[model samples]
Target: MDKRDLVIRPIRAEDIGAVQDFLFTQLQELFAQDGQAAITDDVWGLGKTYLEPDNCNMWAVFTPEGTVVGTAAICAYNGRIELLKGRYHLPTTAEVGRCYIDAKLRRQGIGSKLVEAMTQFCKDHGYRTMYLHTHHFLPGGFNFWQKQGFAITIDQGGSLEIVHMEKIL
Candidate 1:
């Protein structure tokens, strides 16, 4: 199918299984795990969070035929807010949980659509800021975020291999 066949929309409960399948099966096959092990079904209460009428939700890019190709999600974050001890952060009242696009469809703006939908979702839900982390190793990982207007709030690019980025809504 062509890019014109794509449709961006909010993710639903029925789509969870397919999303999880893509994450565990398709993604695992594409990446070199290096014995790090495949992903498990335990998603730290993702299903419950999605089901709840809370600040957490997911969005997907799909074909007109109903094939889900990409998704982005967020969850309420009541964890911590150190880093600055002030209101300089992205509000960071919520956390960007998962965002993924099909390998063959990278750079075609599907990811951007997902991110846009999620950011709008946060804004509609009264979130002032959103925080997320991505691996420095991924190709275009940092640039994609930077291009999306997400600033590097915290660069924990040490041995952890993750760089935390935030977008002030």
Candidate 2:
């Protein structure tokens, strides 16, 4: 498909239901393959909280036909990490989270575009830094973030397992 066929836009309130459905569907498929059930209602509730306007900023990637094929979010919050003491960091740094692209559209550059759009949005909103945590198990995620100029800022628990990366906007 031509790159011009894709469009990225800010997510609206009405898109929340469809986005939640998409995420639940994907999670269900993942658990079923592992002989487990879909996530519990409480977990879904927490996800809803994260997606709420008070907690996050969200955007959706759509096809020319208007199908919502991918989603990305940035959560603004405060943390008290000792490493940040007396340093120049935004009081409202944004953390990228809940990025998902339709399985059928994987490797079509949709994810990368969505992330770039989100980062640009953060910069426009006066945020100075962006961060995200990703599991090493996800193929290409680590490398993708690195290619986008994010560096590993923290490796929690000394496991070098779950990585937290950051980029200054």
Candidate 3:
């Protein structure tokens, strides 16, 4: 497909179903390979977690046919991490996640576009920091965030080896 044909924009109510399906499939594939995965509440409740929150938003990359091929989003921190509670105000921090591109469409800059859109959203919404966690098992996941200016704040080494990353916006 032509890279020029892909469009990235904030998702609307009508796009929720497609976006959720895309996310679930991607997570399932990753889990099948690594034997670890949890589809977050945000994935199941995109409308409430993303669409309903004033400071949260999700963007999807759509094909010319309007299929959701990529997604990225940010939501209020809401005390997900005790480590961040003392250092940053919960409301002013955004937790970034659901950043995935269709495997066939990877490395074509779609992920960067989604991240760019979310960063812009954070700036417009007055967020001071952005946080995200990616499992080391995901190929290039950590390196990708590093390229986007996120630095490792914590690396929980265990079965999943969750790497928590953050970027100051």
Candidate 4:
């Protein structure tokens, strides 16, 4: 649990597989609960996309032995900003998602460390606000974002209810 025992850095090409497996495993569990397929949008495995996109970045938290324990992303999703801008008067927003931490490692501060790194990355990249979309299905989704200073802005229920949250940053 010591800070020095972990490293947080931009994900590399080789990291895509392990990170993808980690994320897909989580998604699979959710899908199984609904008796659905585990497959998700193909973008989850695209490490190069995260690297080459403008104002987009992702990090993987690794143990001293180099096992990836957590991940976070800050991406340029301007299209989603209109929803917040029209309603909340929020400024330019960077979208943050694709964050996951190995369940066994939860409560050890790895998630916070990833978020801190992404926050610095966003600030350095000139983002003064952030937006994230999470559904109630995601474990600890609401509370975690709230603890990170994000407030729930919208939640719409249909076949699925997506929660939208924002932070002034």
Alpha carbon lDDT of each predicted model: 0.71, 0.69, 0.87, 0.74
Q: What is the lDDT of residue 82 in candidate 3?
A: 70
lDDT for each residue of candidate 2 in 32-77, tens digit (9 for 90 to 100): 5535554345225534644464546777776777667777778674
Q: Each candidate: RMSD to true structure?
A: 3.2, 4.4, 1.4, 3.1
What is candidate 4's lDDT per residue for 1-169, written digit by digit as tens?
6657788899878888877776677666554665555435535646655777768888888888777777788876566445555553233567887788777776667778888888888888778887887777767767788888888888865545578888876
Give TM-scores for every candidate, taking all chains together and pairing residue i with residue i: 0.81, 0.73, 0.94, 0.82
Best-performing candidate as measured by lDDT: 3
RMSD of 1: 3.2
Query: Residue by residue across 1-169, what tens digits does model 1's lDDT show?
Result: 6877898877677877777766665446534545444344334354776647577787777878787787777877655546544643334467776577777898988888778788888888888888777767666778899999988877876644668787888
Stretch of 10 with least lDDT, candidate 2: 38-47
lDDT of 3 by residue, 13-102 (tens): 999999989999988887676567676788888999899978889999999999998899888887757755676678788899889988
Question: What ranking of all candidate models by TM-score puts the best one first?
Answer: 3, 4, 1, 2
lDDT of 3: 0.87
Stretches of model 1 off by over 4 angstroms after superposition? 26-32, 37-45, 80-92
